[model samples]
Target chain A: MENENLIEVNHLTKVFASRGVMSKGQIKAVDDVSFSMPQEKPTILTLAGESGSGKTTIARLILGFIKPTSGKILYQGRDIWKMTKDEWVRYRKEVQAVFQDPYGAFNPLHKVDRVLTIPIRKFKLANSEEEATDLISEALGVVGLKTDEVLGKYPHQLSGGQRQRIMLARAFLLKPKLIVADEPVSMIDASLRASILNVMLDLKSKFSISFLYITHDLSTARYVSDNIIVMYLGSIMEMGPVDKVLVKPLHPYVKLLIDSVPVPDPERRWKNRIELPRIEITSQSLQTRGCKFYPRCSQRMEKCSKERPDLANVEEDRWVACHLYQ
Target chain B: MPDTLLDVRNLIAYYMTPTAPVRAVDNVSFNVTEKEILGIAGESGCGKSTLAYSILRLLKPPGYIRGGEVLFKGSDLLKIEEEELRRIRWKHISYIPQSSMNALNPVMRIEEQIGDAIINHEKISKGELRKRIEDLLVSVGLSPSVAHMYPHELSGGMRQRVVIAMAMALDPELIIADEPTTALDVVVQRGILQLLRDIRSKLKASVIMITHDMAAQAQIVDRLAIMYAGKIVEIGDANDLFNDPLHPYSRALISAIPSISEKKKLKGVPGFPPDLRSPPPGCRFYPRCPHRIPGKCNVDEPRLIEVKNDRLVACHLYR
Candidate 1:
């Protein structure tokens, strides 16, 4: 059931309960969510949402960092939660990650070479010392780093772009099938941000790798993604081909997210769209009403506040969860 | 003369480091007409921050204004003594850094910080300073009660407003902001940018915003200068630069922006900006410029000259 899809996630839910006396109720980081990674065709899919959207929880869960309370995750058709030790090793090689902060991932004491060396050794890709150095150099070269300048330099010594590239080079050296990049370029300078983004885009061509580019910036997601999935409060609001979804987004949540983004154009002022509610909608797990976005939705009504809307197909290759669209 | 509010000519500023001399702003020349917002857009290490620090005469060592003149109104900022520069700082050219959290002091209340800047330059007494601080806070759209709160108590947006209010404290002729809204979220960023815009019209003070976010620059800046390595490769009106980018670097940057609904693939310029200390001759962007031909760009240095009406570009193609 799992191997048919590259990664098949069905009803993935994570709920944490506090231990001991003066106990706390369960906190659901991720609610029942179902998604599948298509076979063979690897496109950059964006998991976009603001803080507390449970996007990060989903990433952690998929990476085997946390166990889901209910539901299952199938990587290359194997249930990841129940994978054997040997399977987990193979799984890691298939899914490599580049975290948000490039510097935080590496020890400051070690040089940039150490960052690349760890991955090669972990995967056991290199045969000998000379082969290891060659592979490191090759990875560095792909990311546009010079061995003479940055090889011996510490994380602090390299620029933000270089450090991120070194991290990326480390990931690419694994020759992973899918790369889970969590806000990979947000912390760096705006100019260097694009460089990291390009590395992900080019990797698809150079290494035949697919990227799960996670970010809050829709503009960046639009730039690098082949498909887009808009998430809201622990569940996906919409998912489809990037062209089909973004240009004509059916979900109210997706519409609001797109509207909020400051379009780079200065000529025409954006329409005075409905403002997002300042309140944090945290009472999420008790089972949602009509729509998760009902409280914040501009077109929300009495029906929206009462019924839990199901994800419906509004168009070809697009799924939206909105009452108005229905 | 348009009452040249902040006039800079041939400014040479460099970071005084143990490493090779960083010619951050090498013979860079520009001027901000009174009440106009001039933005300097460039990547990190391009010296946009160094330029802002130089104009304020606020270079904390490791960074020193190497040579050239920074004439704000009639006064030569470089020629001014430390005592004179201090008097001129908040009064003539105020500064707002990337993050307001660090710019403000933790121990003191908000009112005191605003009052301190007022007292440092003006002859106003404590009673008069309190009234002025209240007015300044109100002008920047912050509640007057905020003056009672410490820096940490307020949100990022509120603290930024406090910083803006501080920058506009003395009603300075020029406000140099280095990535003022980069730390904020989209909605918060819009609010901060609106506040800056509101102040720009009311105070009629020139704003020199140094940022790498071209989107922010397009939305706010009247004119823009694109820097590569440590040189301004292109400079023109924001609209013109975006629509008709003359330099290859500027073109690549404009195209680099991800369109929300568009499907076109973003073509990132193949290589990185050259090392400042030992930049190649001819065109500084020659290494990455796709149009680079052998003898033309590799042989001689290209100077920034007028390419079209009110637009300047530095490239052998333009020459």
Candidate 2:
């Protein structure tokens, strides 16, 4: 049966035990998160938040780097964790990942060509050596990189933008249904970020590849993503279409986040200064019951402390987990 | 002009590699006025940090100032003796190095680290030092108890605050913060930038903020300088520069920034930044600039010239 959804994350939760000698408690890195990608439509969904917000944890969970402590992640109607060997291989090939640090992703010793060639050989993407070479050049060309310039060079020889593009090319070669890009353009220079982002946009429209674009930056998130998921302290603060969620944020946390993003225009400088919470929200101090963002939220209420708000649909196709909406 | 706090004239610093001298900061000249925030923005390897280090005479071996005059309070910093420079280092001028948040000593308590910076410069009583440390922590929006805790106990933003507190320990007239908020998150980064702005006003200090983040520069900088391949490509009032940039490199850079308020087609500057060791004879950004005049840009290097009131640009088009 052709599954309607490409990937479905059902009530996903990941708890990491805090190893600090002083505090031996569990950190709920991801808490009761659920979303899905459609198999037919290619869309860029961004998971954006500050550091320690569990955006990367969700990416890791989806990529199967670490097993979720609870909940099911169904890929094409199959449980990813309980997949057979064939299913696992198919899953790995169909789902690709591009990490933040381009330099760190590649083996320093290997030539850059190995990044493309090894994938082709392993996945049996080509019938023969000639076909593999053709495929390599095509993939590189798709990402706007010439084969000769990048093929024989070491990772360090190329600029950060080129290295990142090479990673994109590698992903393109696999013809992945989904690519979990975690901070892909954050390490690259500002001038080079647009090219990489444009390439992601092109891949979506041209090749019809869905992207789970994870980043802390809202500007870029708003640029490429069709949908946006705002996470804070291991829970979804808001999730909806990018235009609706970012423009008219229902949750106070999303509003604060959008406000914090420094607009490039000088005409619209920030008027009010934000007051950060003096007390740090450590895992040990997390109430385990209330809204996770209560400590920092500006519009937090008394009800926020007593009961946790579920990810409730507050608007048309917009979901906000906040007491204000309730 | 608003009482120039620091004036840099024809500053040139190069890293002497075995093969050749990498002209990291070449013919860079700018000034910081009283209580001004001057932002130096460029891609990595554009020598933004080196320019700051050169101003302080902090460059190590393989890196030396070729030619420059750093006039701080009417005195030539480059020609000053080590003894005179040491006295002026923290008292008159201070530096917050790039990623200095992680530079804190994990074992030492925050107070001890802050105290070390103070006693090294001047003598103060233990009681006075303790009180000063508490005051510094509170000023940066941290609690007094933070002084007693180790670096590991504080979050990234809080540690950054502690570093800022240490920089302001002596109440210097100028503070050079290199990528002060690069490692931080958006909300945390806003708070830190605000703290820097507050510190500037409270202490009446001029700041030279070096970062590639143009948005962060827009938020805090009073004047902005765009650097390309070891040279100042554009400099103007932050508002004017953002409103209408002159240099093609500056225009490309400004346009490249993704904005949530406006959705427009973004284009990265084509090609890579030229290697500083063997830069092109003409315009360094010629290869990447969209408005490159083939024969002219490849032959004649453009000099930084005043295009308008307080606006400087280095480009053949402007000339």
Top candidate on TM-score is 2
lDDT (Cα, tens digit) per residue for candidate 2, span A159-215: 999999999999999999999999999999999999999999999999999999999
Report the number of clashing residue pairs per model: 6, 0
In angstroms, give how far residue B235 of model 2 lies from its true place: 0.7
- Tens digit of per-residue lDDT, candidate 1, span A57-141: 8899889999889999998778997889999999998898889888898788877777778777878898999999998888888
- Runs off by more than 4 Å, candidate 2: none
Q: Candidate 1 lDDT, tens digit per residue, B1-319?
A: 4667777788888776666877788878877888888889988778888888888777887777788888877789899798988888889788897776577898899998888888877898778888898888877666688889888666666788789999998888788888898766565576667766767888888888888887778778888999887778899988878888988888888887776756576666666666677778777888888888889888987788998988998887886
The DockQ of each candidate is 0.29, 0.79
Q: What is the lDDT of residue B34 in candidate 2?
A: 96
Model 1 C-alpha lDDT versus the unseen true structure: 0.80
Best by DockQ: 2
Model 1 TM: 0.85
**Candidate 1: where is the Cα deviation over 4 Å?**
A1-3, A10-34, A67-72, A76-79, A107-111, A126-163, A187-199, A205-208, A232-235, A269-316, A321-323, B106-154, B293-300
